[model samples]
Target: LSLSGFINIYLQKTFVSKQLSNLLINGVQPPPLPSKKKVVVDFSSPNIAKEMHVGHLRSTIIGDSMCRLFEFLGYEVLRLNHVGDWGTQFGMLIAHLQDMFPDYLTVSPPIGDLQAFYKFQKIYDCLDIKLIERGESYYQDQMVEVVKEFEKKGLVELDEGRKVVFPPGQPIPLTVVKSDGGYTYDTSDLAAIRQRIFEEKADIIIYVTDSGQSTHFQVVFAAVQLIGWYDPKVIRVEHAGFGVVLGEDK
Candidate 1:
């Protein structure tokens, strides 16, 4: 087609899209998904109490765009902010919280005020971001089961006293559980994937992190695949990784 003709057609399509964008549904019928689709987007998981830097900003912007696009397409999107609220660091945080709020140690201590404080620490009063804060600690029990099942199935092998799974083609073998029987990030990540698949019924689970975690997610997704938790034909798991930030001077 000629350049002018093509431009005219594209303009018409764009105009139509803008017109129908607000009409999510004519009546009770809703927009269509490509297929049986539930998406779980894991993103912007800054460690608790840590400062938000360039890395966090990049992740948030990229992930939010992805979520917005998927939601607009009528996909059931689970926006999972995989916050670092688990493991020993949390023990330290809890100790500090207890020290500051001594009543935390007391029997039938006050929690209402603290809870309210957490809930209201927002950017603005009138703005609604619809943020639901759920800690990774909430999934501790589920992670235990996930690791135990791997142990039971012999899917993991011990490497120098640490339970690990060396998925083929990956240099970094995933640590299923520590020598002390504590779960590692590998165990927790796989467990979260299982939760998204079975409980949330997510057909596509995406991890949006820096390229550093690309291999990590590969192994986690592979572990789930090996465990028969998901099939590539039926479900999809992806790692949408981004590059590192460097000073312009460098």
Candidate 2:
């Protein structure tokens, strides 16, 4: 036999021996090849006081699959459920709670069932998906700082008394703050992205939602790029948007 043929046989035997050793030692489990990068996935963001619909379920499953894949690749994954826990609607709920229980501040009211936020936790547990709850309300205070950052960078423009940020190439500007001084979804998303980048130190950020919100996230991502939050070349930020789930009425 030639020298090249002998070398090929030896290499094939070595590969087979390694596979046999791995099978005996680790069974069906694959060895972990650790990576340094961190990934943050935002998904299953159902609003507080609302039931989990098919859209939320689809996002949850898809996001969990992505997280598993990342983990298998040894990338650090932060699973986030960015629930809609704040806004004008919550303000009305708070007012009603205060009226029902005058000492709401001192004594915890039994508003758990009414809020319906914890109900989703059970579903998540059943799905065996681990996630950290970082709702919009968590960044309510940080939204002010977000607006300040935009203003400091001279990216914000006053459009008829509302604070808006117009991303390059986008015709409509994102309303970060309304004329009534209330923060919109744009403000919360900005704060969340900043936190994930600067605080969470995520090398990659993925937002999983329905296709209907594709433009909204595109605008938010563009605004973040404009604000100099993270270099697009170094950090990967994307929207894993899926098709909308419609009823059979149509």
Candidate 3:
């Protein structure tokens, strides 16, 4: 046979080898990691007292799948439900709740419809208020403190009465604090990351969200890395972004 013919025969044999079939059928599971590495799969972080929308469903499904995969792979998977239990929105919610029920602290109010109650306590609020939550109150001060410390290091700066970080080569600067001096999503995320790394000892941290927030996560990740909180060598951080789940045009 010609050289080319012989090469073709060899390739065919290699592809259809009995060993290959066995490997494929048996599924060669990779050996476990050297040590039980701590991994935090931060996903499905829906805020408390809010209706879970399609977005929340997406995160929950995908995050659960990842957790299963990691667990099977022999890593110490921490299925972190990074619940959105913090921020200015919660402040508004509490204040409104207090106005509605002054004894809310001492007495547990009967909530008939969460969505309705959350949407319009007395007057109709924003349209998006239907899925509001009240979870991150404790992190309020912590987030502010974290941003202020970053500001002292020259990483975060005040643009217009708001503390922010304009990352190198990035267009939109991450707003840690707003003009009202209220802590934003950026500040809470930083505080969470700091705690995850230092306290939780998360060697590998992953955030699963839709592609829309890609820039937001990127900016926050960069900010933390710049401030020396995240060192690539010691720990790994990634944003597992997915595309949108659009409805078909009927």
List clash counts for every candidate, in order: 0, 0, 3
Candidate 2 stretches with Cα past 4 Å from truth are 1-35, 95-118
Q: Residues 79-122, candidate 3: write the lDDT tens digits.
A: 76555665556677788889899998899876876755343322
Q: Give the alpha carbon lDDT tens digit for every residue of 1-250 in model 2.
A: 6555344434588899999998998776745565579999998888775556666889999999999988877789999999878887788878988899999889998866755645767888899989998888899889999999889999888989998899998756899989999999889999999999999999999999999999998889888888888899999999999999788984
Q: Give candidate 1 misplaced runs (Cα > 4 Å).
A: 1-36, 95-129, 247-250
TM-score of each: 0.74, 0.82, 0.74
Give the C-alpha lDDT of model 1. 0.75
- Pick the winner on lDDT between candidates 2 and 3: 2
TM-score of 3: 0.74
lDDT for each of the candidates? 0.75, 0.87, 0.73
Residue 123 accuracy (lDDT) in model 3: 23
Give the TM-score (vs. native) of candidate 1.
Answer: 0.74
Judged by lDDT, which candidate is best? 2
Residue-level error in angstroms, candidate 2, position 29: 7.1
Q: Supply the global lDDT for candidate 3.
A: 0.73
